[model samples]
Target: MAQVDRQQWDVVVVGAGGAGLRAAIEARERGARTAVVCKSLFGKAHTVMAEGGIAASMGNVNGHDNWQVHFRDTMRGGKFLGQWRMAELHAREAPDRVWELETWGALFDRTPDGRISQRNFGGHEYPRLAHVGDRTGLELIRTLQQKATALQQEDFAAYGDHEARLKVFQECTVTRVLKDGGRVAGAFCYERESGRFFVLEAPAVVLATGGIGKSFKTTSNSWEYTGDGHALALLAGAPLLNMEFVQFHPTGMVWPPSVKGILVTESVRGDGGVLRNSDGRRFMFDYVPDVFKDKYAQTEDEADRWYEDPDGNRRPPELLPRDEVARAINAEVKAGRGSPHGGVFLDVSTRMSPERVKRRLPSMYHQFKELADVDITAEPMEVGPTCHYVMGGVAVDSETAAAEGVPGLFAAGEVAGGMHGSNRLGGNSLSDLLVFGRRAGLHAAALAAAPGPRPRVSPEQVDAAAAEALAPFHAREGAENPYTLHQELQSAMNDLVGIIRREDEMAEALRRLASLRERAARAGVEGHRQFNPGWHLALDLRNMLLVSECVARAALERTESRGGHTREDCPAMERAWRPVNLLCRPVEPPPADPAADRIRLERVRTEPIRPDLLALFEKEELVKYLAEEELPE
Candidate 1:
């Protein structure tokens, strides 16, 4: 391996998604020279594809809604397993962040009174989502991109304000995080377009690389969400918490192979969509328990009445939390009420006017028209669950977004754990990116400002990372195809550990993952580094393997169902199970480079809940909120 060109930055953020961009902006504002690195174009990051609105306590739709209620709802939603501090911070700061975005030129939809509009979503006590129809993510990305560009121009005019200008490294893939002694020093990356290696030296590094949804065969996540940050943190000995709690969005398009698993935004439900099977029966009514039974109208007449009167007696069908709705859909399919396409119908045309649908869901309308050739305003959308967000990630303090036990490294957004706990509420993820991403940035920038002696990146460490990166290219005798292995991994995860899980199947999934890991060692690559899908897949496979293993292991350790990690074998929530979190750390290789042992698992202590909040967990208030909320549609 040749010596790569080296550049020093005060802060290096690996990812240009919502979290990364926010972090870069905050760091620049805090007087740190920041660089944003990503594997794709800046605006093309997966954040652009987010369809739902952002969650914030703007109190625009309801005066009763406030941060305290939001905080309480979030805690309950996560089954009391979420870090209370992070949840508190998210609720407190989210409203301000949303307003900040508006100041930055984001044009959110307005309510009847002209305040930022709020909509109902799963697990919220009141309507709190601020949105722009359904294409909230696209609007957000475009606004941030424009802001970044403007900041760049302003910095150029000032010339000496190096901190104001952010250096963006596009098409750069980080292979490994380089540590000096015990702390993170820098990172090793390869430029995809030029096929040249670059060593980025920074005192502070932020990993915002997003979720591990691609580990499943069917997912709503984009190709870039391969869990790179999760793998990188794990390899660097950071503890990953709650790996078992993966969220499955209930309404992914199931028909038409070309558009398979595309997300059907929850806002459709929030706007009055009814989920029905071929039998035309509302199944959630039967599945809902006493907890949610009263909150929603029991009959179709009541549902319609609720729609007619916004503050009426019935809860809309669209307001059901994702888990409850997903389970309901699964039950319908199992009961042989599925449509010909193996999905249930999400019908909104009956409640919403065609013009209203088009105005509110332009992107959704366009997507269905171009991809599935269906007019959503006239027809029912066929939908089912698809792997979406991971609610669990690296354990971090809520205030700082700093990974516990790791110094000089920070995490934010989906990569950092403890905000959502067992499940994430709709519209909360974008807000999380803004609030926590900025916190991580401010903290990292502060550290970077007080300059100490620069840490050294050893030649040996660079060689090892380069060898691992180039192994697939040099393996001429290997028969294992990286793409096939990835497919197999995805299939196994989808079958065994997805939606509802069982012990026997989860064990089998683990066995399959171990086999895939062996094959990944000999995975082959045929094309050059530039624009090579095969090579990119090969590299991404490693991250997928680490994430899959962690998730499988964490699922196995938890013997009770809570939040997203549902186990058919253990059908009930166990209060005793709340004490410990399943923490995973990479096993150190033995001296003389012996084969690495299985990753070690340790049980970390979850902060004890206050006595006052115990009833929320014991009584399962969050679960009730999910089961009963009146969705808008």
Candidate 2:
């Protein structure tokens, strides 16, 4: 066996997205030697692909908008399954974070008054997203990257060496979180370009790796989102919460096969785009669920009028939350109301003027024109649902972002669950990456600073991890292609357990996932490890299959339709299911109990909502789901 490079640090952060970068910065600020490791270039993490904006109660657009309203909207958008404390903190702290970004050189679009301008997004009570035209995410990542880089330069000068207080290890993939006893001691990582192993030994580790979107066929998430953090945490004995709640964002490009699942930003709808069926009828009015009744206009006249006078008229149904719109699109296509591309029409051409559409959403204009050869300023574009985000992740404390049952291990960003609950609203995701990312960094740094002996990784564990990583190359004859298995898994997830699921279909998905997992273990690849895409997929297949099982099992267990999870047989939102959060954990493989294998999923009733927060809602609303004993004054 080759010798693995070993390096020690106070903290190791897996992932280099908005969350991981923020965490690394905070960790370094707290005097911990930190490293941010990622599978791509520093600025190319999925954060840059976010086209909407970050949510914050800056009150630049509407004076009535405040943290409380933002908090309520976030809870409602998530269908109230999110952790109350995290939501509260995110709503309250987000404005400050956004403002701080401006100081760090985030040049956001401004109102006439020179205050940070905000934009409209689905489920937000007021226009609450702080943006930079259509490229808010790019500006955000740029600012953070510049700030972190400046700090890194300062550290390099101070140390008079290449090593800095905060370092970024780009194009590195972490395969395992090394554990010492019950606590995380470090992680096992490999450079993507070289495929050479490196053991990063740190007292504290933060898993900020994003989501599990690649489990499905049509996803907007990058290839890096193969459930690295989810699987790493689970293998380290941490539980994942609400694994079934996956968000399929509406309005992905559907015309061109090459760009089928590519995201078409919600900014189009926020900027006055409309959804129409093949007959040129506005169809969103017919699909509004009862839970969202009275919030959206039901008639074309009212919907059009609402766009001009949102204060007086109900908002248009086109501005409904992503989950609602995605399901509506699915239903329309099923009912033969789809366009030539098997999707509904998103028409901004009829609403916004050509100049306005081009100016406000240059990316969307270019994306459509270049990808599908459609001019959004002149015609409607074909759009449908795409697997966007997973609402479930490593279960963590709302305050600390500490992984359950795993000491010295924490998570944030999309990897940490219980923030968005059943479905995340637009703009909330960016705020989540900041609010919780900072918390995880601060807490992980503190954990590293605590008075104790530094955690250490055992040589035996290192050898085992290395052997496991190398097993795909040493497989005997008759091995299968990792890509083939990945395609099969994606087909299973897309066909059976997608946006609309059924009892029998989900059960079949579980059986298929089990078979895939078994087969993935025998995934083999040719050639050496260096820059080998096949070898990488062979490893990622394990994580995807494991996370897919978690999703399939939890979807089967949760009998009610809520938020992103819709069961055709169980369509109504059952109030009784509101307080329960299904928790997923993997037992030892091939257990004596068949049910005790990779995914031992079970429900854990969530802690009752805090009394003070519960008091914010109306009495009528509280009684709908909460018991008298659970409600507070």
Candidate 3:
């Protein structure tokens, strides 16, 4: 076997998505030589697909919106499972981050008062999302990409100064993290184009490798979101938290089978789109909780009235939380009120002007025009739930984004757990990437400032990883297609462990995942290593298996339905449930005990809510009561 060469670096960041790019930039600014490794092209990371705006309490559209409100909304939205400190930091810092993006040439929509526009979203009490029309993620990625490009230019101009350098290795897939005496040293990577292995030795390593949504068959997440960071951290002995709580976006395009699961941005609803059944009846009014009952209009007359007088009446039917909307759509489809593709309708034409719709939702219009041959301005779009984001990930501290129990290993963005908790509100993820990404970079750079000698990379470890990576190519057995297995995994997840779950279905999902894991061991590839889709899928399959097991096992352990882990068997949320977090650690394969082979689950400690925070919930209830009493007809 040919051995690959190795190199040393001050800091190595994996997964060049929004979080990785942001962290790399910050690390460079902090005077550390930083290298970014990604499996795909830099600009093509999954962050580009996020269409909804970034949530920030900018107080642009509504004076009532503020950081406190944003914080409270985030906590409630996550069902209080989120770390209060992280939520607090995210809420407070998000406004400045969004504004910082503006300074870097991001052109967001303007409010009537000429400030960055804020719009209403599910779980937010007031309009607080800072947006660039509808393709906010695109604008964000473009701006950040440009900024990183500029930084690279500046770094080159600095004449080989390590402090200002940022080295990006595109299409380089990290196979395993290298550890030194219980600390993360660096990682072993394989360059896709050259099919050559390399070692990056550093004092600090950051994993910003997004979510595990590819585990599910029908999802809004991109092909690259294979839960790499989650698996890597688990393999490196870091605990993963809340792995069961997966957020399914309420509206995804449900026609043209190829694009069936593409996310139909939440901004559609925020901009006055209404979800309806075949009979043209709005269904969300009947499903909302008492907290939002007074705030939501039931009748079409009331909805139209609320639309016309935004602040004078209740909120329109479209702005319900994702969970509520998903459940409503499920009921609608089950009751035989669905469209041809087994989805309900999202109609925006009734509420917004065609010109306004086109301007605010260019992507939505373009997607429909290019893919479905349907125009959003003329007809209702078929929509349903699609697995989008993971609320669970490698357990980490709110401040440092450093993985708990794992020294020298840090995580940020979708990979690091505990920010969103049980459910994430729309637009919060972008803010999460920026806030935690920067924190991880700063923290890692500070740790690197001591300049410990580079740890040695084990040739044996690299060889083992390389063998596993290349095993697919050498398989001579009957063709075992990775894509087919991936589809099966996704289907199983979507059907059994989806928006709603029951104990039996979750158990079945676990069984299916175990079978998939066994099959993945024999999975085959029929192509060379360079840009081989088969090889990529095979690598991603391992991640999907680990993540799926984590999610399924966590779901079965939690007896109550709360937020995204809705269990039909335990239909109601138990007060005793109280934000119980499941921590996952990978168990090495041995003389397999059938029972023990299952995901080993353990509950983690959660600090009691402060009296002041508990008081706020009480105050919110009182406000809800008063609003109910003063309800408008």
Q: Tell me each candidate's TM-score.
A: 0.94, 0.97, 0.94
Candidate 1 pairs with clashing backbones: 270-633, 271-633, 272-633, 273-633, 315-630, 316-630, 318-631, 319-631
Error of 3 at 26 (Å): 1.1
Q: Candidate 1 overall Cα lDDT vs. reference?
A: 0.83
TM-score top scorer: 2
Q: What tens-digit string does per-residue lDDT give for candidate 2 at 594-615?
A: 2234888777777888777776
Stretches off by above 4 angstroms in model 1 are 160-164, 312-314, 590-597, 610-633
- Candidate 3 per-residue lDDT, tens place, 271-385, comes to 7899888988888777878767777777778878866765544777577777777878988898899988889999999888999999989988987888879889989989998
TM-score of 3: 0.94
Ranking by lDDT: 2, 1, 3
Which pairs clash in the backbone of model 3? 216-490, 217-490
Ranking by TM-score: 2, 1, 3
Model 2: CA > 4 A from native: 589-596, 625-633
